[model samples]
Target: MIRKFLLAALLASATTAQAHEVWIERDGTGPARIYLGEPGEPVPEGGDPEFAKLKAPKLINHNGAALVRKAGYLEVAVPAGDVRAWDDAVFEPWGEAGKKESVVYYARAGRSETRAAMPFEIAPVTAHGDRFVVLRDGKPVAGARVTVITPDKWSKGFIADASGVLRVPVREKGRYLLSATQKDEGAIAHPSGTLAALHRIATTSFVVE
Candidate 1:
């Protein structure tokens, strides 16, 4: 019974770490505006809707120009060319046991999409159809679970192959989010004890008509 309880506790911890996802929510599109958030039921029930509570998130153009905007949520417009946005690292430390850190990103490819300029990042190594790759410190991360979400919260999960590439079929194509959660066995040692740290990253993109 004690062993079973420990197993359940471990599973619960892992699930909590996997819950962080970064995705884009499109509002109106006269010039094409997008909001960022973790797609969930709604706010107040653990939903951080519409880029709520984030600092001045910015949209960067391919030419290295950046536009900073402010709001209760993050809203930005992609330029006529390639653009991308990334979040500051959000770290969650639970007890002396360990910590879980995640960074979320969104990119609108102008020509071709490759690895993002993030330390622990995930991006599309292929077209936005289905295949993607997860990278930690800019290297392929195998064994990460990439959760694919379609409209209405329809979700399917895929595992990264040895090359850290994921291939999952896109059914219809509206808005999609691909999230990856990875946990390594290394932890930072504090004065308290050895603290375990898990790394997770996610990306959101879409297929347009």
Candidate 2:
């Protein structure tokens, strides 16, 4: 009971940090599009302002794929593979007036890959399964909080166990988004300026059929 309470509290604290995330979506034989917004929310004409902030991320599992600007997302040329995206260009101070922090974003398209390819990543436990592991610097991040958005926009939060693994309950046959946030202490010196705390938000998307 105490453990569950602690997990719930952690998830609650990440509400604002995980409010919006970068996710990738790709249907069969379709272009892999990277979107910046809340899952299930309507994107604006050119995506949210934050979307504009997205420079090219260090894409894994594919090479030489250009990010084409679109009305609401960035389109990739890759048709398959893990096709993950990790961008630290958004490493700027964010938040209201005095309490801002340096934030970075990582995203992944849930393919049949079980290896961690980003500094912070959410990878499948098996070639085919709802079980996922949250990793930071190639290591499991125990107690990490994960929030999942389903096809119907229904959502739920879960805490990674000691092994940094969590099984998502898949009840529908459609796309799903999973997000997690990790906070680190200390200030950071960026070319832009000095940043307060550091926060990393990672999101993964997959289609379940």
Candidate 3:
């Protein structure tokens, strides 16, 4: 019974980490910040352990840019073009005994730039950021779950259609952040070890007028 209880606790921790979302947001005419937490919530001063595992994410368009560690998030320069960020440094095993697997996270900041830019991406379908398509490896990830966070801290959940397109209910005019995730069970080798699953997380942020 004690072993079972410990197993349950481990699984619960893994689920909490997986449920966290990563996104990048920029205020008007300011530098972009990469945040990890539930949308609209205040980030902790030291950040979560999972968040600390992330080294610096690569800015797709701005290759040589630097990431400055802030109090609770990482800041980066936003160039004229659309901003996108990708990271896979959080490589560690999670889950209990028989179901153990490792996960890697990928994030994006802007609209669809290219497949090479972000392996997993949420591309805007409409001119505004209300509609999006979830893509993995350049292919549509149908039935993907997407969480939308409005400027006022309001949040809603939506699922992608057969074509991977999803429409978000945008009510006000401010910054919107959308997060989507996809999982692949194929095995692959990494410096950390052999990864049994690939967890792809994509987020796109935009301002609506």
Candidate 4:
């Protein structure tokens, strides 16, 4: 019968080339077995069976806490700290990928909480030497909103104490292009927005010289 209709059209094109990415393995002492779907690209060399098909979903934080998911993607669990706030509910999909779907969000903590969100440091102002100090995970990110562009001058705002850190008081140092921003308080969700569609928010940036 024409090879049974070409074997059902190659199994319907491998089930429509299945997609829905996001996978991470390491489940034992701290829970880390997140998977979504179409998980078929470098995840098949163990118990085989196509690595059991891939579906995983029963997220149980248990105190290794921090698993936000509104727009999707953000899985902390280990010392769990850094992750200030950005928007997108905090991340938690499992399927129905968006952000231009083709999903691929995976995480497996440990190693001091994955180095505790390090990214924001520009120290170099030994006593008002034009000024420059913007540490993040190492502390000192007050107000947080610095922008220093110089072709002639264009400095701009914030960072003065809340522990997010920022301190750029320059007056004449030249060669500047520093940038920093922080304005993600749940991003934009209004059912009375404060974070409720599952909640998630984390935004951090760097680049100072």
All candidates' TM-scores?
0.62, 0.82, 0.82, 0.19
RMSD of 2: 8.0
**Regions more than 4 Å wrong, model 1:** 1-18, 25-37, 40-52, 58-72, 89-111, 184-198
Pick by lDDT: which candidate is best? 2
lDDT of 4: 0.34
Residue range 135-199, candidate 1, lDDT tens digits: 87888988778777675568788889999987766677465656665544566543334556534
Model 4 per-residue lDDT tens digits across residues 1-209: 99778668655533432333333333234433333332223334343232233333323234334554321223435433222212221122221112111111222222212232333333433432335445554666666554544424454555555644445544443333344433323234343233311211112221222
lDDT of 3 by residue, 1-209 (tens): 99899889777766766777677877655788887766556566677556776667777768788899876688887675467777666545766444456555556655534343567888877554467888877788889998888888888889899999888887889878888776677566656666666566778888776
Q: What is the C-alpha lDDT of each candidate?
A: 0.52, 0.79, 0.72, 0.34
C-alpha positional error of residue 162 in candidate 3 after TM-score superposition, expressed in Å: 1.9
Judging by TM-score, tell me the better candidate of 1 and 4. 1
Give candidate 2's whole-model lDDT. Answer: 0.79
Model 3, which residues run further than 4 Å from truth?
Answer: 1-9, 45-50, 96-99, 112-116
Give candidate 4 regions above 4 Å deviation: 25-29, 38-51, 54-209
Cα lDDT tens digits, model 2, 75-150, are 9888666678876664345544345466678898865889988899888999768999999999999988999989
Model 4, C-alpha of 75: deviation from truth (Å): 14
Candidate 3 residue 93 Cα shift, in angstroms, is 2.0
Q: Once all C-alphas are superposed, what RMSD does model 1 give against the true structure?
A: 6.4
Better of 1 and 2 by lDDT: 2
Using TM-score as the yardstick, the better of models 1 and 3 is 3
In terms of lDDT, model 3 sits at 0.72
